[model samples]
Target: MPKDQLLRLQALEAAERRMKIWTIPLQTPNNRGAFLRRFIERVSDRNLHTAVPAQNQSAVQKAAQFYQSCSLVYTTGGERELSTVRRLLADFGVFWPRLSNASNLLRICFAMSAVLDWAPVILFSLARPGHIVVTPAPFYAFLLGRRRAMLSSSNDGREYKSYFSHMVDTFRRQEPSSDVLSYYELLAMESQIVPALQQAYTAADGGIIKNGTLDDILNLAGEAIPRSKWDDELGKNFKSAIPNDTTALRFVIENVFFFAEFFALMDNLSESQLAYYVGWTAVQGLSLFTKPAVINFYYPSRSQALQGHVMACGALSHHYMGLAFYANYIREEFSAHELADVIALVNHVRKFFREGFSSSGALKEFIDKSQQSLDQNAPFPSAASAPLSFVTDSQEGQLNELFRHFPDQKPSIFDNIQSVAVARRMTRADTRAANFRWNGKVRLYYLTDDKRFELLPTALEPPFYSAEAPPAVKYGALGAEIGDAMAALVSMWLRDADENTRAKVYTEALCRHNRPVIPVETATTQVPSWPNISRRELAERVVSLNAAFRAFLDATDGGNQYRLDGYESLTGKRMFFIIWCMAQCGASYGKQKCHDPLRLFRYFARAFECKVGSVMSTIRECT
Candidate 1:
């Protein structure tokens, strides 16, 4: 080799040696402390110093020179240094893998570098379902730096950089779309390519009612954009031309105000309280997003109505996932103050929304309408409202009244739920039925008592009703009514009731219900029994099955494929529904049975369109 080549090889070899030496496990009291001590010692002795050619050093050498004077251990303390590195690793993708010993410097560097390589995946991972990624100021700041670096480079990869840069910018501004649902600002403003909506809204002097920015107006004003303003010729020229759902929009307006009030009230909460608020807030988001679809039974089942409910439900589910992430992150680090804040916020939100629940809204509306009709011997209200074209005068007055009552104190989750329940109720009301009119305040009172019964764990099988039959009216009209109440009660229990109260309700609803039940597991049946399944196992199975079916349908059916082959769709739909219910299981099961086997089989039946008459028979005869 030439002299220069020999020198370059020697330098490379030396650098590799140093990398290996740095990662060697230090025998110190704490793993972090050991690393810090080594880093300090190396810095003190200037051991990291590299003698590169003065005139023609490579890019790596230039970068190294820039870092040389800085403390390899930049923070004031060892713990801080370890934490910083760990966060960077977590953010990049090199999360702390389970290991017993400290890694060598080469291994650590390799891991960190791999994490850097997978940064995109890591960022997207933050958007996982039922998880909320809390981007603290420091984390966002770090991302901003990374974004700047990415932007500076003009490679094709810069598009990805731009995408991620947008995400980081949104995070800093507290408008992360990874968790957006009801918030219009979050959906509209966070996009990199989307036009600046807030500026546009302000510029037009409220002339245009943009669909993308609808959430902003509702949040700012406790009403939808006035039709007079939105109906302007210029408004038609802008992006607000889409026909928005008046009912949902009204609900959003009311609830946004409620949320704002609740948040303001919670500003004084302790750290722990805040943490709980974070968790509960996510749960609330889940409930809200899923509320529309879940409450469809009460609606007249029109296509547009169904679509609105489903879309809203999905958006809520997505937001909840984000909240879950935040909750999981903060659970470990929450202080007493945060805990206090969480509890306070939960209580506050719950209290605030009680009125909405008590009103003629949601399930209560269904109940109220039905009861009144029965009182007068009239038919159930089936006529759908005219697309809820706009919020009624009454809603505007109510919102104004609420604002007056809690001018300083914002409404909480309870208030929002109440608003949603009320809004949904409005969507279902019989405008002409004097008997169905409910003018009283709405309250969510529970029918709780000490009772337990073994629920079938699954809905009843055929002879009870073939898969082709419409969903069994087994819960008769009255029973169905009670079941709706039970669902609402159970949801509320998960939110505000005690574990025992929840357990009591679950036991009664499942165990004591008036129905012949099929055993979840077969003991002396014709077919061999599946192994006993844990709740965790069950959850995994359901998620896997849903994913599989979703994939299959996406592949076969034009992405949104899934025709109701009569009740065939019901089987698969029921399976996913079970998964949904199980996801929010809470203390409902109470050790009665895992209910996994039945759920799994049901999912399979739905996916494959298998007839389960014999299976149902076997389940019934198991005992």
Candidate 2:
């Protein structure tokens, strides 16, 4: 090789090393845990060089201390602290032993308390603006273990029952109580609930129950519980008085079956039995904050020494203190210049979609309809601002207030976690709610109601994006992401169009061809048959990839100007497609093999000069 090529190879190696520093460790399960631990430690480090506002410093410190306390409690907490937690449960009338004295209302209160502590135990959970969403209970799913296996027909429920029994035995040992239900009875109750939960979890998106009001939900739930009880519990949860007329409050019921099954079970089971089940679920929720033995019980074969502690603590912190972690992360990792570049790139992509759709005679009507919706929706205040911005001062102030209630003197991990939960519950009724939703994730999402996009801070980091990368590479990765979001918005608009308009657009943009079959081994029962890509999905992928490719060409003067250091053998166009394919590599299992959009892009064929009638070129059916 020439000296110039060798020098380029050296540069590529250094870049790969830096990328591996973040990406390679995530390939294996154990290394993934260690990576997360290191990440949390860096986020929690007090000596961060970034300048956080003095007012926000206390909030960041409290958030860090909260994670530290959870780690310490998980590793070193003893029976005394565990006993206090048990007493705390008793105070809420959540007794382990079957206590006949606990009333139906008391059981409801216990479940509500658990919800306030961010460990909801009910089928329907509270959402923003006082909405209640009927969905699967994640707490129950955690107890079942292996969600996919538990939901499969082959699962006999024996493994989950055994796991439940072990959990009960572990908790029972912490505080011995008499008259507790036999593990068999508990398993039977769970069996009845699991089927309904599974139904909700597996319900098809098209089968979504339309949005209704609280009154509609109560009617669907039947007369199992009186309306007064619901009104009282909901009012308490929302921290406001629910009016006699609750038709104004929205209820997003995704699955009606789950609510029906849940209420029927509630009506039939005895009060004492309900209390025992609810208490058990609550105790399991607090298992993370309990002794090492309780925490380790869930890990089983996995090493519990350092990796487990970090993983558990890191997960719990993210779940409970997401906003604080996000604030700290952006302060330390993200730069203003990178944010500006991303914002400009996203705006460019948006402009491309706008102009392309408006100019196309076939899509003109669709764009007109979408433009009307956008004007009417008048984007949410947060969405109206730049898509890629940091957490606001108001958001940080609310976070500080959330942590202010926790005692400075080291409180038990349970106490600290519960305090944060209570604070969140208290502020749920406020008009200016904290904008912590999806701020910590590494993805871009489109808000349909707001007609805007929001890109989280983490998506700007390595593997997905880098400020130093050439325009072609950046467009290949983040540009494609932006295009995908825009495509989704187009699909949403198309879905709302009149039947004639949709049919016309589909007839023009989508053409069906016989999909080739891929052979699978007979023994692989775990793999389900892959469905043919829908016309809408194919259309979206085409629109996304084409828009991204066009944007790249426009940005780099028809893809002739930009080049990667070691990839000089390839043109910018080829590098663009290659990096787009490489970005999704190893992101999922078996998905890329079956559902990769690249195989359907005609541009992919043209970029690499594939022969006619080949798999890549044959995608002309869709194009």
Candidate 3:
């Protein structure tokens, strides 16, 4: 009787006429009326439903009345009738919960169901026969469902609307596709995923819904596509008639091989695998907090400053996962078969990283170079033989190009700090210092300063020094010792938390670097002829001056901002930036040849909480 309910019904009717999507009889009679009358008399609020007159009617009319009334109910409280009412309403083609209240996952299921239901028509309309949708969830879902007959279908052998219907009917019914992540499963996993992965499983198992099964489901999802099925076929697609140097053919085969093997390795039962997966997932999730995904900013323009930060976090996650795989391979004692697979994956990633460091626009350069590199017959490089390949000239060039864009006037640390700064949340200076370690020019910002944490001179110049230079030598010795201490602290903290804890402990620890450290030599500088700038006075000036000259030092220090902005807002963007910066710093400092590997590893690992290891949750900080 009310204008809105009538309009909704009219709209559904009109949609049926134009789209011919579905139809439902518009009436129901007395048995439903008794249920409705009984339900309505109990409601204290009269305006809850459109004014459906309580009267004697046909079964279809009464059913329609009941459906409309049930649809209007927002949520199920303690009422026992609500379940029965919802089931009946669903049968009448009112499947959605209230439009505003529907979860995002539900919307996805609905849309996917529509697509699956209409797949035959869709296929006919398309000119291309092999087109695939690129959305992460839908693609994953389609693969998940079709790979296994998880749900019955009607639209051709491929349609899947019924699954969606089942998914939404209740929460527990939304299970992982015996093949991709389902909404219900994602929700279940997310609710229980602690930093401590094992504990998370225990917690989930203890709950009404089963937990800790995400890994099993995720692992099983990949198993649906077996290596035997795709191996020879993928190889034959790229085999050239050429004998020795078929670079193009080799690249394709190798990548396909790498992806498949790596996918399997990701499912391994090794301790490293557990740590790596949990940490990687944590990094991905943490990105949401620092970036917020709300603001619309261009990547190289307004958002350039944040780009490295984001990439740093993302890359670190990848790097750690890669390391975990490496460590697991090492732990297993490197048999020939395992080594072959490990080498292939390492080459794939190294190939990817090398392409980045190669040229002006590395991404563009990579697309062209990769095609060429893949054709070659040479075996892909390993950690031992492929140092040049992994951290290649091209990636270095790209990093330099990226770092050059940060304005070169002086050594200021916070040029783009404003993007992350929120009210009362000025970026703690330590964030900038932490971020600098990841900017790829570690020696420039750190080496010349004696690792003393003092602010840089307002007048620093370019091409500070090579790793082979005298200053770097000094840094290698002393910085290594300090770095060791840092790592020990991080390893212990990470091991102790439940699997679900955010890696925030690492973030908080790195902030300590913001407070400048005093060298023992400077403890008693007594310059009687000159006013002594107390160490505290010196540190304050360093922080303030870095903030002051952020725009000028873009070249010497790369485009990193030394100023204290965006520290408070702590958006996902900043989190990504900070975490990434830390990763770069770790990789740079932790490189095998640079300093004492054990010491350097412990130092940055502590700072980063060794978030990259496999099941070795905590690598001791070299204290």
Cα lDDT, all candidates: 0.27, 0.56, 0.25
- Writing each residue's lDDT as its tens digit, candidate 1 over 194-249 gives 12221221121122222324345334433322444432321222112123332232
Worst 10 residues of 3 by lDDT: 118-127
Off by over 4 Å in 3: 1-184, 190-225, 236-623
Best by lDDT: 2
lDDT of 3 by residue, 158-189 (tens): 32333333333431224433323344443343
Better of 1 and 3 by lDDT: 1
Off by over 4 Å in 1: 1-159, 162-379, 382-486, 489-499, 512-623
lDDT of 2 at 512: 38
Query: How far off is residue 285 in model 3, in Å?
Result: 12
Give the backbone clash total of model 1: 42
- C-alpha TM-scores of all predictions: 0.21, 0.72, 0.18
TM-score of 1: 0.21
